[model samples]
Target: MSIAPARIDEQTIRALPKAEVHVHLEGTFSLIDLLTLAKENGVALPGPAATLFDISTHTDFETPEVTTGGGTGTGSAGLSGFLRFLDWQCGLVRTPEQAARVAYAFAARQSASGVRYSDVIVNPTHWNAWRGRDLALMDALSAGFDEAEQDGLCRVGIAYSLLRGQTAADAEDAVARLADASLRRVVALSVDGDEKTTGRTGEKFQNAFAIAASAGLHRTVHAGESSGPEGVWDAIDLLQAERIDHGVRAIEDDALIARLIADGVSLGVCPRSNITLGIYDGWASHPLPRLLAAGVRVTLNTDDPAPMGTSLEADWAVAADQFGFSHDDMVGFARRSLEASFADDDLKRDLLTELEAVVTASTAAEVTA
Candidate 1:
């Protein structure tokens, strides 16, 4: 009789070294944190703190447009709902101290989840309360990350998020914000938001991205999520994004898949995020397996951990269980994450070494058993 393989569990998944490159800092806040911040800032709540904190209801992201100020149109319907919730959370932090606290908490939480290093995406424009104080806000957020590093929780880097659907002039102003010396912690410039609502692509912000490239900032743009493979191509050809967020849709086009493989571009794939937003019906239907088999560099991430109800480890466990990944395959996923990160060489080297040793020890023990 043939023997069945052993199962992978959460414990094993959590023990592996991992990194999250596509997560948004604004979405990391816990419900309790949101309540506290709202109370501290005197921001009025839309409903009972307890009721709004219930993310169980918020899981249905396919609902109609719920907010007025953000954007409009068809494709924007899905992600715009999440963005409105994000705007509410961002609006709660009215002070520099609050921003610092939120940042510190985010690092600590991810560290506890087994993330050794993270590139957190922060879009200043989302924080309505911090208008005209972006420099101070960046400095405060950096201070929080610095304190977390000093305590050996997790090393964190910032990726300034550029909102989509803005005018060329607005894009120029967005790039100018990163020129501040106090925002030295920023290592990359990223674009996100509803591609469908904006009815635009990477070409719209090429000049702004060119400025970021001139300033030595790495690029990662969201594409092929709500739109299609054309968005991914525009990001690669026009913005020259080093990494593409949610590029799983590239599987739809064979030529695009060839280009992604040839160029070694990494895709930050969030399986749960896709399912939750109605992009894919469920985990088994996700294109992760095809993307991997096609030789494209892919890494699992929680686009918004707290709100999306996922973590790096949870994503790994799901991948292992759903896709039949072995222990070695899981390790490869972790390794791919570090390789795809925008972290400095020194930090990446250290994290990769630590990851390799952990995987070796664990696999050896499994063999001995």
Candidate 2:
């Protein structure tokens, strides 16, 4: 008789303390939620909401320049096409009430998935409701986060993301507004979008990031996903990014890999999202294992959980099945995420302690079994 391996269960994955640092708020809404929003706001519902969220339908999302010949460009479809979808999804929210609902729900979902902490990124420009009113949007979003924290769901902080195509002047203005807002729940500043389509480099926004850093704000940048190793270099050398979201392409350059390891920078790797976005063919081809072996601090995340049809639990399972990460390795990934977060030291310590206890208990149970 053949022996079968035990299957990973929710109980097993949920028992581990997880932290997410690269999720996007716009991409979190479900088809049902979008439909509800449309009905409530009197906005015409888009047809086949299911197709909108399906990555298979948008195979052209990743442009040929980056996906083939290892060329360097935004890895996704041209700006007009991808942005059309992104903007359509983002346009669903026309009021603070909708924003708050999404934020609170996201926290609850993450809590149930064993994510103890997260730093959710949202690009304010995408929302017409937040046009020329960044503070209002921040306040509304923060209120939602506050409720979630009080309810003991999960601790979440907002990372205000700058769109990639924004001018230097626009970047400075946004950062200044962020500093002035000084929202308690807002923890970091980030830049996200298609780097290849925008033709913008990290150097373009160095001064804006500098201003944010001077304000004691944490920084992360989207790099090496759609672009190449040089994009990662610019993020580290020019923008002084503390973390690189979807930096799988960093494996292309030995010097960049060494630098990331030496500097203790974290790479928030999203496995499913990379494949869905055409950055990689599959998890096996992803740079995560290489990055890990090269001593880079790697943390698994769900970049666009809903759109990519992934959750923290799902990502963790994939990492274990594909990467062959042991239980201890999963725990290490969680621990590093908490450490890399913008969360306070006390929270980090508490979460770390809880994770240690989980490991101990799991080990004891295994021994007994």
Misplaced by over 4 Å in model 1 are: 53-78, 180-182
The C-alpha TM-scores of every prediction are 0.92, 0.91
Error of 1 at 149 (Å): 0.4
lDDT: worst 10-residue window of model 1: 65-74
Residue 64 of candidate 1: its Cα lDDT?
28
Best by TM-score: 1
- Candidate 2 Cα deviation (angstroms), residue 104: 0.4
Question: Pick by lDDT: which candidate is best?
Answer: 1
lDDT of 1 by residue, 19-137 (tens): 88888887788888887987786666665666774543454322223232221112544455556677777877877788888999999988887888898988777787777677678
